[model samples]
Target: MAASLTLHPDRALPLDREQRAVAREIYGQTAHLPLICMHGHVEAEVLASNTAFADPARLLVTPDHYVTRMLVSQGIAPETLGVRRVDGGPTETDSRAIWKTFCANWKLYRGTPSRYWLEHELVEVFGVDQVPSAESADALYDRISERIAEPGFRPQQLLDTFNIELISTTDPAGSDLAHHAGLARQGLGERVVPTFRPDAVVHLDRPSWRDDVAALAKVSGTGTGDYAGFLDALRERRAAFAAAGGLATDHGHLLADTTPLEPAEAAAIYDQALAGTVTADQAARFAAHMLYVFAGMSCDDGLVMQIHPGVLRDHHAGIAAKHGPDVGFDIPFAAEFTTALRPMLQTYGHDPRFRAILFTLDETVYSRELAPLAGAYPSLRLGAPWWFLDTPGGMQRFRETAVDTAGFYNTSGFVDDTRAFASIPARHDLSRRVDAGFLARLVLEHRLNLDEATETAVDLAYNLPKIAYQRRI
Candidate 1:
């Protein structure tokens, strides 16, 4: 017999009776607030077409690197989980087999955020009543597949069901944003917006950098022979994104360095990069310089700037080469924001027109570096704990450490930062529960009254992200 699945109503509440009651009250005030997903990796085309999702394996197992990476760590191949290989290698083509593999190894995800999100998706989103196991995998698969085929389970319909007020999809700098335009025609533009992501064009060390630059020139209708023209092209693209209802720009750099180089020096480095003669040091320096340039552009324009630094992406070259990037090999390194961001912060930290939300994977920096920096700079806001640190314990640590220095207002509230569309509500719901528990503890400690905690819960859930992302709607 398959075990029955149940989501305890008080799953993340405080253990103490008095504190749990306060948490429940606080949670009640923010439970149903509309989600404001300021930054994520979901494609606009999915919603633009409102297409029905594929089978359960494709929808749930394949695209989630968090799930596949865990399975891979336990000696299961990613291709066996339905991940396509870039080298045309043989992979498991059967979706049912993939589902069975995932279901068989479900226990590996215990105490993981991925498990929490997956359980919430299965129970709340798909209405599945049986826990996943090797024995029940096929039956669960058929049930989810049937439900996904229905019109009410389409992408756009799910967005409404999830109560996503405003969601942003990351787009390459050279993208035409045709899907965004199409959504506008379909009258869904205001609900979904594009985010300007220029990593491919800015990171000169990537093997595809030149090809991406060529594509940027083609789309921006600008010359790439000179640095000035390249900057102009990027500026033009940002403007186009703004016209398409974009509110922010996202940068995923290995480091948070914002040191600026002289224009001639920057131009020389760009020329070397274009000539295929730029050294690794030159590439790093140029990328750092471009970060400063991006901040200046954000100040000139009004797009909120988000920096997610300190990730060593594609940590395993063999896996990356075979399966492509974002296959869950990215690892975090210690980040030093105090010195790395000094140049840009000194330049724009006090500028009212400029806004930056900084995310770090390094937990050690919360109290020592990031919180103090955010406390000092009016333009800087601490982003929520992200990537590897988005778990329940990580969220609790973030609140405990950063709240003392930066306080609630200096932080940008929860952002899902996900590619898995169905996990958005689950992620946000987890955040709300975690925040309510944290606030409840504060009330229990006599640091705050119930009324204050209640209002702050609403702010953390809904108001802060809207204000921080600069979303008009």
Candidate 2:
């Protein structure tokens, strides 16, 4: 018989039996609520097709960077993980072999949040009573593979099983959202929605930036060779996405500094950009101006704008060249949100028409930059503890620094921010559990009423992410 996998509860709770029961009670209260995933990177194609997933390794091991990075760290190859690139290539081919390699390296995840999530998925989702290790790996893998290949384990079925009411998939500005349209026509309207991501069009320094903008111009039937035309093209695309049920726009800029340049200056920069002769500063200027242009568009369109700044993307040149992005190579840099967001916020913050949701990797700025800005501005709102800080320690740090000043309402709720399908429930469940632990602290310490903590817990898990992202469409 396989041993039961142990759960590592947070140390914040007291060691006594009575306190642990309180923790259980808090979890029980929030466990059954409908999940709200306002921002994430799960493929729309999975839901649109409603197809059965291939196998356990294909679903969990290969596609997830969190899994692959750890496995690779333990001497597993990226090819073994089945990561695909733009050129239709991968390092490894044999699915069975990949599963074997992953199983051998499963101990790499010990004590990680991934370990907890994966164990939960194995036990709860797949009915695996045994712990996953090299010893029982093949038995667990084969059973999971058999179940995933079944009709009852299809994407839609899994979504329903996971109790996901609202999920937002991030899309590039140039995207036609054809899959999303298909899903809606199939009557999966509330199940999935797109969030506008102008990264491809706005990040002028990106390798394929000009071509992506050109694609946008052609698809929207608007000329983007010039500054005015570029804005018009983006606006037209936004309208199409709006009609398709996208609610908010997401921007991942290196800096939050926004610039609304005069037409002539913007035009000159656009000319330089199209000619591929622009300097680094010119590109920054153009990207900054485009942010302002996006805000102006959002005011007219009623789509909430989200700004996630301060990630020094692809920090390791050697790792990035070999592995591309989202390979666990991204690093956090010191960010200045107050002054950086000033150019955009000063112009749009007072306007009720414009709502901007801000996220940061810089925890130092939570109280200093984010809290005060979100607390003061009508357009601005704080996003949840993002990518790096989604862990228990990170969430605690975020709440400690920001909650007192910004309050819970100023901040949006949890987003899984994952591309992997199986991990969604696990991620949301972890967030719910952590929030309960935090609120439970408030009740135990007399910082808040027990009843109010319950309501707040529900809001953090279910309501705030949806409401703050303004994801009606």
Candidate 3:
């Protein structure tokens, strides 16, 4: 017999009786507030096309690195999970086989946040009642496939059902943004906007850097033969994004260094990079200098700058070579923000127009480096726990560590930086429950009154994201 699946309403609340009661009350106040997803990887075309999802495997397994990476760690091959290979290698073509493999390994997710989100999506979103396992895999697959084929299961309908007030999609610097434009034609533009991410053109060490620069020049109608022309092209592209409702720019670098270079030095490095004569040290210097340039552009353009540094992307060389980027091998390293960001902070930390949100995979920096920086700099705001640290325990630790120094206003609220569309509500719900529990503990300790806790819960869930991202809507 298959075990029945259930999701308790008070799943993530505190264990103490008094605190749990307070948490329940606090959660009730903000649980239904619409989600404000300021940063995510969901493509705009998925919603613009408004197409019905293909199957359970494609919907839940293949696109989610969180799920696939776990399976890979357990010695299951990516081909079995239907992840396409860059080398045109054979992958599982049958959806049912992929679904069965995922279901069989469902128990591997024990005590994981992925398990919580996946279960919430299954029970609450899809009305799935039976626990996923080898025995029930086929039945669950058929049921989910049938539901997806229904008109109500389309992407746009799901977004409406999720009660998402606003969401942003990350786009490369050279993107044409036709999908975003298409959303506007369908009267859904305000709800979904683009975010400028220029890593491809900014990172000189990437193999495709020259191609990306050429594409940027073509799109922005500027020549890239000179360093000044490249800067002008980036400025023009930022303006284009702003005109199309973009509110933020995202930077993902290996380090948080933002040192600037003199014009002659910067131009020489750029020339070396373009001529394929740049050393690794020169490339690192150029990337750091570009971070400073990105800040200056954000200050002039009013687009909130979001820096997520410290990720050593594609850690597994073999996996990365076989399957392209985002195959879930990214690892975190120790990050030092105070000294690394001193140059940029000194230049624009006091500028009223400059707003920068900082995120780190290194939790060690939260209380020591990040909180102190955000507490003092008017333009700096600490981004929520992100990537590997976006779990319930991680969020709890974040509140405890940074709240005293940075306070609630100096921190950006939950952004749901996810690629999985179905898990948005679940992720946000988890954050809300964890936050309510944190706030309730303060109330139980007599540190905060009930009224103040309620207001702060609402701010953490909804209001702070809008203010931090400068989202007018």
Cα deviation of 274, candidate 1, in Å:
0.9
Per-candidate RMSD vs. true structure?
1.1, 2.2, 1.2
Compared with the true structure, what per-residue lDDT tens digits does model 3 show for residues 1-473?
78999999899999998899999999999999999999888988898999989999999999999999999999999888888899999999899999999999999999889999999999988889999999999999988988889999898888789999999999999998889999989888888989999999988878889999999999999999889999999999999898888999999988999999898998888898899988888888888999999888888889999999999999999988998898889999998899999999999998888899999998889999999999999999999899899899999999999999999889998989999999999999999999999999999889999999999999999999999999322
Please list the residue runs of candidate 3 whose C-alpha ends up more than 4 Å from where it truly belongs after superposition.
471-473
**Mind giving the per-residue lDDT tens digits that candidate 1 earns over 1-473?**
89999899998888999999999999999999999999788999998988899899999989998988899999998888878899888999899999999999999999999999999999999999999999999999999998899989999888889999999999999898999999999998889999999999998989999999998898899888789999999999999999999999999999999999999999999999899998999889998999999988998888999999999999999999999998989989998899999999989899898999999999999999999999989999999999999999999999999999999999999988898999999999999999999999999999999999999999999999999999322
List candidate 2 segments past 4 Å from native. Answer: 1-3, 6-19, 85-90, 471-473
Q: Is candidate 2 or candidate 3 better by TM-score?
A: 3
lDDT for each of the candidates? 0.93, 0.80, 0.92
The model with the greatest lDDT is 1
lDDT string, candidate 2, 303-412, tens digits: 99888888898887866667677677677898787776788887888987888888888888998889999888967788888887777777878888888998888888
By TM-score rank, best first, the candidates go: 1, 3, 2
Measured against the true structure, the TM-scores of the candidates, in listed sequence, are 0.99, 0.94, 0.99
For candidate 2, the TM-score is 0.94
lDDT of 2 at 378: 69
What C-alpha lDDT, on a 0 to 100 scale, does residue 364 get in candidate 2?
89
